[model samples]
Target chain A: MTSASKSLTAETLIVQEVAPRDGLQIEPVFVPTEAKIALVDALSAAGFTRIEVSSFVSPKAVPALRDAAEVFAGIARRPGTVYVALVPNLKGAERALAAGADEINLVMSASETHNRANMGMSCEASLEAFGHMVAAARGTRATINATIATAFGCPFEGPQAVEKVEALVARYGDLGVDGVTLADTTGMANPRQVADLVRRTLARVPAERLTLHVHNTRGAGIANVLAAHGAGARRFDAALGGLGGCPFAPGATGNVCTEDLVSLCHEMGLETGLDLAALIGLARGLPALVGHEVPGQVAKAGRPCDLHPAPARKAA
Target chain B: MTSASKSLTAETLIVQEVAPRDGLQIEPVFVPTEAKIALVDALSAAGFTRIEVSSFVSPKAVPALRDAAEVFAGIARRPGTVYVALVPNLKGAERALAAGADEINLVMSASETHNRANMGMSCEASLEAFGHMVAAARGTRATINATIATAFGCPFEGPQAVEKVEALVARYGDLGVDGVTLADTTGMANPRQVADLVRRTLARVPAERLTLHVHNTRGAGIANVLAAHGAGARRFDAALGGLGGCPFAPGATGNVCTEDLVSLCHEMGLETGLDLAALIGLARGLPALVGHEVPGQVAKAGRPCDLHPAPARKAA
Candidate 1:
């Protein structure tokens, strides 16, 4: 934890690669366990300090990620990279710990309607369950990260209240969770909203203990990230090929593309400490796995500095 | 001009819809003249104060927009909405003026390499030609706009010098053009670059006389627009359904989507004065016109306020 904290300087932003977990989880075709392990291992070499490997949810609920245990077990962990797993309950947390997850990420929607639809639980019940899981994980080496889904907005319930989100984050703080992720599950976030909410959240939570998970459903993902960064957030969750969609958020698109975000940060002179080319290669390779072109732009357009030769003129 | 200028208050931004012109110029298939007129008429009804109708270039050079004459002649002109046409040379300007275009938009690449590749002439030659066009349009009731293409970067000649762009804008000002458009022709612009360039350009050009034309080749289009807006640029050129691309820049994607940009402005409480739902409907109609799905996101994902019903729960 000391080394991880030290690695993130004032100029450095932490990009937690979540393609294996968040991206693949929403994919219809179940990616082979070996392929998932390969992706995680490749991402580990791409200078990412953290990578979310898989989710330990009910097999019936998300069959695409049913091989989470196999993927976690098969991947060769890098020395400094923190590999995380999404845990829906105590059972999932227990399975994740057993499979050697460095951290367990818990998710619950901020809106009661969304919470009921997504997890079949009330917000209070979800918080109580996470509290129990926090206690249960205290004995293990794994840390806990409570992600409040639809923290920005909900499909079933338009805009979410900032107070509701703040209370949830406060509860996660009280439960001694390692961090909290404010996810724009359906991409309903705007720059002004992001700046305001992130500024308020930083008042209660440390910047290092916060991560912004923005979706591009409305094509405002990168702008929202910039606003959150301006408001003192240092960590963001992105997928390799901009893959990931909330099953609950109608018309929701993928998470912000890792390559696109990296390109933006690099262009702005913000240090991301990640190999952009390696991430682009990974993103380009994803269409083969997903059976279609992904949403990432940098992979196709090349970096801003990638120049082309002058075309040969024909005789006029 | 006074009422139009008055409508654009400090809190208001002008959106110049360019789907009929710049958006379809690089498209492989030629949209019928009637469809182009229909789109222009619908956009005029949607509260767009300005619309780029078509480019009067050589039919041999750009067959996709060869019906420019018919498009400009067929559309019923709206009183408040200014109908503009792209004029590459004195011939194009004459054709535009004859067709009753309100404004003639002259284009020339800032980079010598791109100028030669795109317009088959040196930058000096293109500017000289535009100078003649500007002089020719002086007595015609048609205003002139000098659009400096590849103002941010060139595919053949990397990043453009701000000094060179400023010099061009200063030249356009000397030539007595009505406006100047700094085009990021290849989508190679970042927000910081946009802010710096727009701020410097605004020092030499009036806010009303300047337009920021950005492409989304690298996914920074909307962010760049926001930066330019922050730096005192009030007018922007956007394409319906993100339909435009630079033929000279390899792998360059579409111009910023008009509906998506409108959504962003509306969400931020900045007044666009455009009917968003009507614009979205026109955007949704673009696929049939172009024979492929367009790139705008607002049509696919809908607006943020568009809510969905909660899923009916089954007995657990």
Candidate 2:
């Protein structure tokens, strides 16, 4: 009935869970290793096809996820659940590979200034390093995926040029990565920008190989996801309890919430193969785990299908 | 570049400010009458074409806005700006017209159970009352608008039949409302549902007379707005600082934020005719007035075009 509904063809949408890695990385207190494993296992059991378990960065860099190795080793590997890990360089890639990561996700900023501030290197240098890292894991069991951080806009640089993002996708495709994720590092993406980038990126990479990662920092995260989905891009990265933020990006908050996205997709008649009730249960545990309230909403406001009893007394 | 983007052609989107009424109606403490007048004045100077100043309901019914008449009398009304007031019955409508309201907004719930619970009357009773209220305001200089609350879904009734909403809208048209607003009272709305309802409603109403009012309860407020905008809904109702929630709806939160929506529209290349910087400044003052934090994002995150300085030291 609408252009957006008409543009969407695929019935099933892929939701890649990134709570453990992206969500907890910015926390002041480190989550217990067992809790990390438990969170990933719960997400896996809740029907997530892919889960970013942790990152293989230096403990000094992100002390919260320092127990990445223990977390990976402790999780009960579900056969269908592909475990993913973020890698900064060849050393991190090797660590992740040794920890049995099914997919190694590499990230670089689309904005040169953000790249310099975040990775302590130039965009050219980061791509060169990624090329070597991809070659190193070419014959391994791990599939590689490159993420263009700040693909929508940068905290240090305004809106990124669509041509630069498309070129980055092309470069990653040429580098022989299994997939690519366009990351809105600070929730700076709008739905229109997302649709434009997703449409152009799809020309360079197949739908199955592209992921849209967004944040609800400016309240357009889910809208951006809807735009990408309408443009035929399916896979999405969301954090459980809407936890996650870039420490380097001022005013950055939660990523597009997992349960909320699943709820919206399910309501729109899109299959996410997820248990919304179970996801809500896990989200309800986030505040206690992080010692603060999380930004997720569906956990607080039940699904639309969840009916309430009539009020006992008349409301004024 | 994309279907959704192509669907948006009107360069300027109308933002109807509902903060003075919807936002403060649910507040625990009453804002001073002078403060309310100042807010209305500030919002008028900020270029809002329409502002819901207050409601003419009984003081016992909505004590927060008890000084509605005083507030209306104290403000300096601007030219080209419509000052609206919510009227529950013929008496309320008369009161609003006597107080010199530019537009009288009448509201009824689409869901029968919600209507009964919220208004302490059936949908038929509310409609009958609105008929009289509309008739009362017809000969006056004030324009009349009818709002269908819980148009998306009702917490007590669940998903409302689109046919039922259409019937209500058609009935409102027959009663001769100058315009109509479809409100997602508790934010139980998704992008697809919004697109469908908006497209169907637009078939019965012209683009200029239809307004989409959504809340950020489940984090789909902005997305729903985007969907409606794509479906040819040019007018929208937003609360400053994302303030406002239905007291009858158990888990209700803030309405779609004014500053966040404007920031998004500007970023998406849509004109709102409102000042983003001025709106953000007003939003920043919400905490002091309400004695708590608000749910707004852009007030904290800044606009996407807002850039940050490079970190002095490299971020790890």
Candidate 3:
């Protein structure tokens, strides 16, 4: 349950679109480079302040995004929108920097089991590697966002400890990363856990410097977002049409849907600075690109304000 | 955006299962009488305190629930679980009474346009008819639950005024109904509106006597339930597997999903007195009965605590 007085808070919520990278990375089929670029352009035109373009990793590791360089090069970069790319190590960081990424999102799982399972290394090794990547970007104009994967819960390790996440974030803060992201890698977060963890994390990091990457695998994605936002988390990562999943986590579904999250924020009178209609259009068009219908609801159900015409007057 | 002090409220939340009636009523295929009875029996065995069996509307009006009598007659009633049925008029009330329903859910719409379109009469006419139905059940052991459909918003008409809902509930109170349900018929409700209206309704009615019937048409059903529950509403109506939709409202989905809502409540440490695993089994079996995939998430995503084994160790 939520607090009545707490629900009345009005503030500008920042939604960072991540469909181009996190959303498409897990797809079985590789999306064409042109389509990925078009999606990024469309998202930028729709007024998103931030968009994760693609991940610069070994093509063998994530073949779906093998065209990361082509995508970043082809997209029509908007003036105010920051384009980000996920970087796994120093080599990936070099590629991301060369591809003109505005920011590099370096990831390290909180749980050792998950870090080993996903990244093929121990948590300490991954952090040490991130240190190299952070140092490599020192002279570049691009900033760095250190993302702690499985920050909420790990499929291999179960619920994660808040102190573990705090320690990892403190390390990232020490590395001088521009921002920190707490990702619910398996969609295993509940509202209470999210609120508690976010509140604790905020005490260590600034609200503007923290972001939430939530998955809807268990249907708590939107609720967790509300809880985290209520706990002073300002930036949220959402995938258009609820695309993407964790290949390592069995039965894990898509990330928190972009249009759905925007709809929730807009309906609650929170400003998102994103055009919902444009986002819905892009979400509706995702099925053809991904070869299936997406999990986003607003495209199918329409907005709350979308009214239907009254039934035709019955014959007298 | 959320006050830290406000998250400490702990209260027992009640979830009223409504799949047998509201869920089946909108289904295009008519579920067999035996299957309906089995579903209700399984739900009763799952520890739900309340289960709506079926509606007593004209068979021609809702052919899917045409076997309401057989369903009500056949279920192995659980002593602690209250079996309810929807009744539209005096005749329907008589049938429900004969079929051994413990409670009769009377239906009327708050919006005049919806009331006329749904019930084929004016608001006053429906209330007057309910008066007759109430009078006819004077000596019966069955209680009455007055359900104001589209209490939050109407697909044909925009938002229904809070005064309209208050006046309707006042009339129900004057008629001596046992409980009142605010039905978000088309899923047009937002959290703020739900909280505002629920708070206003609770001021006029007792919390124990109020129920929230939410639809997930716009993905706000669960959020609305959280909002209303925070505003002092204790009872809620949910359909298993998110089965059901409003035939009158285009693109309207099912009621707040029973499994999903129970998952949220259980995760939040709220008591629902329902076995989630058993309920999920019943929800998963619904696709066979209704000839389509149900919209629930738990059946597909599994619970957050349902963990997977770690991947096999990779050779060095």
Candidate 4:
């Protein structure tokens, strides 16, 4: 110890870029399909192996992604990339397959009340639909992942029972699905709960088959992800600018911010192959694209360490 | 298994609250000393074992905390509670001593540029001052802690070299201070970085003498805290509402919200005797105190697994 060495470990993490889909969903403006394509192309060039490009919801339900097919078809796909799309039901799955989505992500709220409110279906129906989608996509080249919404907690139903999550995971595990994602859709996850659920989910489902898709609605999204990782999860779903929340939870902020997540993973020595400067540049341009100020801090402030005094006060 | 049987990790994590001092510093409004007192009193009754009540800095520097003395004197101090006051220099230290602060927290930015801009002193000068204060405080029955500000990253300087943090800890150790607090003053820390730093810092500084003070500036604050805990750190510093930020750094949010932090730790099976609901109530009342909506999620949204909508919402 030459008195200068102080870091305990150099652990690396992966960052899945979700700006194209989740980040753009909440914007009032419907970015031109070409703009969405450019964003995807830029992110792909910036070394994102996995990027969620669009959703397969009805054009009217999420008008922001009305040109989802156009956007996906327009993007210049890099050879080694995985392009994921969010699918709400069989229609979404069918549309996503038609749009050439490399991966299909299906979500089911753990709470019945939220499930009805979000997808306009009961939990049982959602699971039944999931089974169908899984079966339909079985022979396709695309991988399938299930997101357990409100895995942490929910406003309408209160905290989700862990048994509900376990049962869902078992179902997904039995389906031989590519993966399962646990979401704190309304941000009600506490660290211990997150750790326990992820741990149990991981034990039932392999770590490689589990991902965490958390929303910062209650500000515990990242904490829950950390807890889940502590309980053994390697994949996660995050949005740039922390955009995209349940349509049912109007005031809830979107998923965890991508740049913030990437920064965390990069700083921890995780190998998230994302360029900080490039992500910041991408994040800064998001406001103009979406027609509102985004919630990403790194883009507005640059990296945490880039401190420069404003030039307005320095005429002398 | 029953529905609740799957939630892992029981018990609560100690959430050391720091809102009275850190949360109020960045706001323009000069919260009344009496209000600070009331807040502290309520917080104590609400069950915070350690509360950072006020800061003994120059009124010209942080006008928001000019009444540190009155706030300290006004709160009804509980027998087992530890009341902490932040002190910047000899004058502030003297005032804190006079105010009967149970503990004195000394803070210095790890980056030289930040140290110069925030405190108008070099890190060396701050360390020397810390040594002098430690010597002067020898007879007083108060604990002393040195917080390395911008330990993860700085606004002025980009990535804080881990070596810089180690040097500061070694110096703090030499000064015989009670603990070392690694503060992500700008919330630039990621989980991997936090874990790595915690691991490295623990080798030089014992876990019992190390504390983590995180700001949720970029939404990674709580995640970083969990990462630190995973690396074996126990003590944490957080604000009630996630209020306040550096005036110099526009758009930066404040410290980690206490309610969310406590809930995260509690769910992780840690032991901290804080009531989650009580902390959330305090967080809910903070918007009016500062004339803006503070950024905490759980206080406004409720915790994970919390199924009860407020009785009013239920009635509605």
Candidate 5:
């Protein structure tokens, strides 16, 4: 085996479950606040080190997560599990901080067109707004992080330049954010691009502070994750049952499934510290929660080690 | 970027379209002979250098592919494209050669339980049988290759040993087959394992003569492909629209989607020589052909470069 593949087996990957935030944000139906809290509690019990519990966005803009504060208040936060809440602006940051969120995640798109359409501001304005939010949370316990959406490609703007994302990371660093996530908002990332970008970004940011958030829209999410991991990325974001989609990209699918990602990690001998069966159990319950079958494969098809009984005779 | 990912962009991958054979074999409804022929023809037109047209097995065993002979005879042969037919034994090999197939693919499982359950023979017996078939095709114009199913893992037997798969490759080498394919029948392959296996297998077989066939059952199909590609396996097997499932492993998805694989390769700057647009067009037509929605992502989401128009105003 090559040195790279050998090292992969020894590494530990930190999974940040984004189902409650990214996944539920786009769901057509609003889950009960209690159920949302239960989902986060289940994820925390499943051994996730970090969980994005909810978004502090406007209730009118995203009624699906309208009960975010209630859900956040109700969840039984584990001692080691960092509860994260996504905040759109200074107001959202204040609300999340007041709710005692362990971490506050801010988001802005890398592409100008996506920034305008998603955040109602240009890239410059969004970064400027983020500076005020960072300054506002200066003495708070919440570790501030920013996600650059459409970091790989945008539905409206197409493939993004790597330098544009690098510049955003630098800007986030200047604003004193704790970490940064490169979100493939529309699932436009390829493995090679992921490796190249991760390598370049890691040069600017520490491996522990960088995370990869990808969608499986075109079936390259897992591949991109592996590529980034191979390129020295340690943290990743995944959602339960792959329950998320891009509002702008009409047919785009959800984020990379958490159970599937965990299964792959365990199979590769990488330490995830997450229970596969527990994640699968949570994934299987997602269909009822979302009122539809999910895109996650591990939930439908059991793990590789979960052997099936031998047929009575030749069946295949 | 790492040197491994840099060389990835310079590689030209060989994709063998397996939808006409593997994809159709598990379908409940039979596709018309003309439609099967048209599918192969379309795949050839789409720049697939190799296409597994049909399987020369018992009609009662796989009624969906019962028109194997007719479909093989009707396809408009492209000069540079190789028409491959899957054969089980000498009789099937004779039929494939008689039907004017350019290549013949033989399959046997790596594990004893899978071999007994899939082919009704021991691994020893299957290898002995393949020897006879290989001898029979010694002087024929058709090139002979063997696929070791359950190469990475088995539903009945669980994870396979790399040494066991290596022994199979060595034995196939002794049989003097032109090529060999490592088939992840149930998509149990992880990227690290794929890399390790490919690196070992390539030591026994040349890069051009080795193919990796993986399913997306666990959502790691594309990741395994990239891992093998990075490890020096040049050829891969994928199905149109990700149609097909293992009869033994319930809920196992089809082979990796062809269009998505092609899209990933192109985006990574790897040469696939196939047209992504044409593959997507064929993938989009699969649901109507199969009477259900397929698992392919690119067909539903379009290619990464297939940009969508910007929203009129702030939509996200």
Candidate 6:
């Protein structure tokens, strides 16, 4: 029934744009719903098959994304696009489903402290709720994805045990969820850790149902992503301009800069099916909206091989 | 004679602080010799065992560091600290040796275009002259280290051919230099490229004699370093706060940020004897001298997992 996500041969890759939901929430400036909708519309036209549109967390927690409903209603989404919304709880899942969200994502940290602080629930409670969310979305086209946050490392707990993360994935896999994502919420993970975790998880959860969301906090995000890919997992979740991070987790930066990751992957002969130049342009537009320099280096400095001759030293 | 240097393990990193020579050279402001000496003294006291004290380049090109002699003489060199000087030619080498430099570093770019633009010499000419420099240093304790600039990538040439870099490494290894440092003159390298190059190079050259000098122009500098280490090459050349870039390379940012790199290395259980907090303090002091914020994230944001609770809200 999934139909291979529409003929994604070895040469094709799907870029899931998460700038609106993930990017805006962590940014200091509150991006207007119109601007959010405009950005999403632009991204949709830019050939993004999947775009994570917004999150349904409480306004008190992530105030920048207060207009989740309005932004979801506002985007002129293309027909083939899968609009994903992050749902932190049953209430969030219900809200996202009611707001025309094509897919609902549920995230709970793998570490006990982060699960309680970031998700306001125990790991057991989150797993129990994941079952409820699966039942809630039954019979709807709205796909459900369970994300294991802090799978790599947590703010409270230093290095997460890979077994605990695997257990979380198994529980989610058993709940009939469409997919699972392992997130490096803090950039504390090394490539070896990423390679190890992804390799082990792909054993139980198929590659098609696994996604790795990485943060470039310690500058290892892109390397870790590649390491995971080399370890047999391919699906990735990135925000344009590296725009998202958990605000509750102090010292964390935004998500892995999308354009940078795409550039690296495509250069390495991976078919990400992304228009590199267009994605960079999308990233360039972000810093102005957010009132801070977006951390994506490629967005500011073009690709490495892009060298323009000293522009004909006129009349020298 | 070489036992002490060899005892300093290659896989155990020893960061050669390049801020004095490479970092301050390109600045438009004239930092006083006293302040430069003070910076060196502070760094030396803070456990930077190998610091590039100053450059012996032509004063006309880098007017900021023209007082290299005065700064060198003024510095209070602590025990175990090895002060090195960047020598451009025989004349500069003479001056550096006369100023009691513990070591002398001479560099030539791997790319012909970069070599000519940076040093006004071809690769052949630089290699031959460096052979003479090493022979000259044989009579004294002043060790000679040859640096291959743009070894990973060049501005004029897109990607440096790994064979050319390896050939350069072999030539330098034969020349009896203390070490051969590979530089990513522009941040054009990714982790895969670093791993591939370092792995191939280490098979022919001893990992102990190989050094990597990188820039964060594209944000892959540390990632590349990690890859290089995994491939068995360990020695690294870095500037504090990612200071220093080729003056001629348009839009190039400074070298790889030392504190950030050290933080990553130390956390990974790989030993880099340099103290990160002290390095960060030195980097923070650099903004006043350089007239801008040096691009070291750890200097401003502190390391990952460094938490500061919000001050208790003043009773309204």
Q: Give model 4's share of reference contacts.
A: 0.49
Separately for all candidates shown, the number of backbone clashes (residues 3 or more apart, or on different chains) is: 0, 0, 0, 28, 0, 1
Per-residue error (Å), model 3, residue A151? 1.4
Q: Which candidate model has the greater TM-score, 1 or 4?
A: 1
List ranges where model 6 is wrong by over 4 Å.
Answer: A1-15, A245-252, A310-316, B1-11, B78-81, B245-253, B304-316
Give the range where candidate 1 chain A is weakest over 10 consecutive residues by summed lDDT. Answer: A1-10
Tally clashing residue pairs in candidate 4.
28
- DockQ for all candidate structures vs. native: 0.56, 0.55, 0.43, 0.29, 0.56, 0.26
Model 6: docking quality category: acceptable
> Order the candidates by TM-score, highest first — what do you get?
1, 5, 2, 3, 6, 4
CAPRI-style grade of the A/B interface in model 4: acceptable
- Which residue pairs overlap in candidate 5's backbone? none
lDDT of model 5 at position B245: 82
- The residue-level lDDT of candidate 1 at B172 comes to 90
Alpha-carbon local distance difference test for all models: 0.87, 0.87, 0.84, 0.77, 0.87, 0.77
User: Candidate 5 — which residues are off by over 4 angstroms?
Assistant: A1-10, A248-251, B1-10, B248-251
Question: Per-residue CA lDDT of candidate 5, range A155-263, in tens?
Answer: 9998888898999999998898988999999899998889899999999887878889999999998988888998999889999898898664455568998899999
Cα error, candidate 4, residue B31 (Å): 1.7
Give the alpha carbon lDDT tens digit for every residue of A77-131 in model 3: 8887889999988999999999998899999899998888778888888888989
Chain B TM, cand. 1: 0.96
Q: Give per-residue CA lDDT, model 3, range B1-316, as digits (tens).
A: 0111122233666778888888888888888899888889999899877888999988887899999999988999887678889998889999999988888889999998877777888899899999988887779888888999989888888888899899999999999888899999888887788889999998888777788999887677787888788788888899998887866544445888899888878988887778999988888798888888777888877776877788875432
**CAPRI-style docking class of model 1 based on DockQ:** medium
Interface RMSD per candidate? 2.7, 3.0, 3.1, 6.3, 2.8, 6.1
lDDT of 1 by residue, B1-316 (tens): 3135775566788999998888888888878888888989999999988899998989988899998888878888888788999988889899999989899999998999888877888888887887799889998887888899999999889988999999999889888888899999888888888999999998988888889999988878888898888888999999999888655434445999999989988998999999999988998899899988777788888888988899975233
Supply the global lDDT for candidate 5.
0.87
**Higher-ranked by lDDT: 4 or 5:** 5
lDDT of 4 by residue, B60-98 (tens): 778999999999878898877888889998778878988
Mark the regions of model 1 whose C-alpha exceeds 4 Å error after superposition. A1-4, A7-10, A246-252, A314-316, B1-3, B246-252, B314-316
In model 6, state the lDDT of residue A234.
64
Model 4 segments beyond 4 Å from truth? A1-14, A26-29, A122-124, A131-143, A158-164, A173-176, A195-209, A230-232, A247-251, A305-316, B1-12, B109-113, B122-124, B153-176, B196-209, B308-316
